[model samples]
Target: MSTYAIGDIQGCYEPFRRLLDKIHFDPVKDTLWIAGDLVNRGPGSLEVMRFLFSIRDSVIAVLGNHDLHLLGVAYANRKPGKQDTLTDILLADDREELLTWLRHLKIMHSDAKLGYAMTHAGIPPQWSLTEAAGYARELEAALRSDQFPVFLKDMYGNQPDCWHESLSGTDRLRIITNYFTRMRFCRADGTLDLITKDSANEAPEGFIPWFAHPHRKTVNDQILFGHWAALEGKTDTPQVYALDTGCVWGGQLTAMRLEDKQIFSCGCDDV
Candidate 1:
C-alpha cells in the first residue's frame, strides 16, 4: 500500500479528484494525507467535504486557517468573509457531521515509521518535535471539548506573536494555532509575522520562512506542510516539503508519494 500527501485542496474538488485519479489512488490500499485547507475560496467545498467524509478511513487530515475560520463562523457566530465560498458547506444537510469531523482533525500528525511529520503550516523554530506534538494535543483537546465554541470565539487574533511556556488561556491557544495554520514568515527567535503573505523571498526585514529558521529543532525530521502556495511545492531545504501549489488560485493541484517522493499534478484552470 502506498501513501500520498496532497497539497491544499481549498474547495477545488474537480482538480483534487483529477489529481487523485492521476495518482491512481486506491482507497482500500492507499493512505492519503491531506495538508489541509480542504474547503474555502474555490468552488465545490461541499463536494470536497462529502467525498473526504466518505473516505474517512483512508484519509488523515489536519486543519488549516480557513478550516478554523469556518468553525468560527459556524459555532462562534462569526460572519463569513466576503471572499469566502463556504456557504455551500454551511448550508449542507450534513453540515454538522462534516464540521464535527473537521473539528476533530489533529493540528499536527506524524508517523515514525513513515519518517514524516505534517501540519498545515510549518512548525515553529523553537519547538522540538515533542513540544510541537504536545502543544497540538492541547489545542485539539480544547477544540473537541464542549467549550469549543468559546475557544473558537477567542481563536482569532495576532497577539502574543511569540511562544512562552507561561502563556495561558486564549493567548496561548491562538499563538499555537497560528504556528500550525497561519504561519509563513517568522523571526529566527520564533516570533511570527502574521501579516506578511508575500512570497518567501519577500519576507519582511526581520523575518524568514518558518522552515528557513537557522536553529529549527525539526531540521533533521522530514516535515510536510501546505500553507504557503507561493512556494509552489519547493522548500530547497531537503528535509522540509512544501506541498501547496495554489490550486485555488488557478495553479496546479499537487501530490507527492511518500515512499518514492514522486510528484503528481493536475491543472486547475477550470476549477
Candidate 2:
C-alpha cells in the first residue's frame, strides 16, 4: 500500500479529487496524509469534510489554522473573518458531525516505519521530534477535551511566540498550536514571526524559515507540511517537503508519494 502526503486543501475539493485521481489513490489500499487547512477560502468546505469523513479510515488529517478557526467560530462564538467561505459548513445540517470530526483531528502525525512526519505548518527548530510529538499531544488533548470551547476562546494571538518549558495554561496551548499550525519564519531560538506571510526569502530580519534554521533539531528527518503557500511546494532543504501549492489561489494541488518521493500535481483553474 502506498502512502501519499497532500498539501492544504483549503476547501478546494475539485483539485483535491483530481490530484487523488492523478495519483491513482485507492482508499482501501492507500493511505492519505493531509498536511491540513482542510477547510476555508475556497468553495466546497462542506463537501470536502463529508468526503473525508466518509473515507475516514484511510485518511490522517491534522488540524490547520483554518480548521481551528472554523472550530472557534462554531463552538466559541468567534467571528468568522471576512474572507472566510465557511458559511456553508457552519450552516450545513451535518455541521455538528463535520466539526466534531475536525475537532478530533491530530496536531501532528508521524510514522517511524515510513520515515516521515507531518504537521499543518512545521515543527519548530528548537524541539526534537519527540518533544514536538509530546507538545502535539498536549494541544490535541486540549482540542479534544470538554473545555475545548474554552481553549478556542483563548486560541487567537501571537504573543508568547517562543517556546518555554515552563509555560502553562492558555499560553502554553496557544504557542503549541501556533507552532503546529501557523508557523513560518522563526529565529534559531524558535521565536516565531507570526505576522509575516511572505515567501521564504522575505523573512523578517533575524529570522529564517523554520526548516532552514541552521541548528534545527529535526533536520535529519523527513518532514511534510503545508501552510506556507508562497513556498509553492519548494524548500531547498533536503527531506523537508513543502506541499502547499496554493490550490485555492489558482495554483496546483500537490502530493508526494512517500514510498518513492514521486511528485504529482493537478492545476486548480476549475476550482
Candidate 3:
C-alpha cells in the first residue's frame, strides 16, 4: 500500500483525474494526501469536490485559503467573484454533503509513521508540530460548531501580528488559520505579511518567504505544502516539499509517492 501526496488541484478536475490515472492510485489500498486548494479558481470546482468525496475514505486533506473562503462564501451569502470558478460548487445538487466534508478537514498533519507534517502552507517559525496541531484542532472545532458562521463573518483580518496565547475570540483563531493556510512571505521576526503576492525578488524590504526563515520550529519534521504557487516548487531542504507548481495555470500537476519517493505528473490543460 503506497501513500501519495498531491499538490493543489484548484478545481482543475481533468488534470487531477489524469494525474491519478498516471499514478494508478488505488482507493482500496493506496492513500492520498491532498495539499488542499482542492476547489476554486479553475473550471471544475464541483467536479473535483464530487470526485474527491467519492474517494473520501482514502484521502487526508488540510484546508487551504481557498477552501476556507469557499466556506466563508457559503456561510455569508457572498457571491462568486469574476475570477472565481465557484459557481459549480455553489449550485451543486449535493452541496450540503460536500460542504460538510470540507468543514472537517484539518490544517496540519504530522504522521510519525510517514515522518512528515502536511499542511497547505508551511508551519510558522513560532510553532512546533505539536503546537501547530493543537491550534489546527482548536480552529477545526470552532469551524464545525454552530458558531462557525459567526466566526467566518469576522475571520478576515491580520491583526494581533503574531501568535500569542493571550489573544482570544475570532482574532486568535484567524491568526492561526492564516498562518497555516494563507501565509506565503513573512517578516523576519515572524509576523504574517499578507499584502504581497509577487516574485521572490520583489518582496518588500522586510518580507521573506515563510519557510525560508532561519528559525523554523518544525524543521525537524518534514513539512510538505503548496499554496505558494509562485515559488514554482522549490524548498531549501529535500525534507520540505513545495509541490504547487501552478498546475491550474497550465503547469504540471504533480504527485509523489511517500513510501518510495516516486514522482508522477501530468501536463495541465489550458482553462
Q: Which ten residues in a row have the lowest lDDT in candidate 3?
A: 197-206
lDDT of 3 by residue, 1-271 (tens): 9999998999999999988888889999999999989999889999999999999999999999899889989987656667888877888889999999999888787799888889998888878889888988998898889889887787788786687888899789889888888888787556878888775666777788877777778666788899887877766665789878888887888898988777788889733
**Candidate 1 minimal-lDDT segment of 10 residues:** 262-271
Clashes of 1: 0
Q: Judged by lDDT, which candidate is best?
A: 2
Residues 1-271, candidate 1: write the lDDT tens digits.
Answer: 9999998999998998989888899999999999989999989999999999999999999999999999999999999999999999999899999999999998999999999999999899999899999999999999999999999999999998999999999999999999999999998778999988889899999889999987899889999999998898888887899999999897988999999999999999643
**Which portions of model 2 show Cα errors greater than 4 Å?**
none
- Each model's lDDT comes to 0.93, 0.94, 0.85
Q: Give one digit per residue, the lDDT tens place, for model 2 in 156-175.
A: 99989999999999999999
Order of all candidates by lDDT, from best down to worst? Answer: 2, 1, 3
Candidate 1 positional error at 55, Å = 0.4
Measured over all alpha carbons after superposition, the RMSD of each candidate to the real structure, in angstroms, is 1.0, 1.0, 1.6
State the local distance difference test value for candidate 3: 0.85
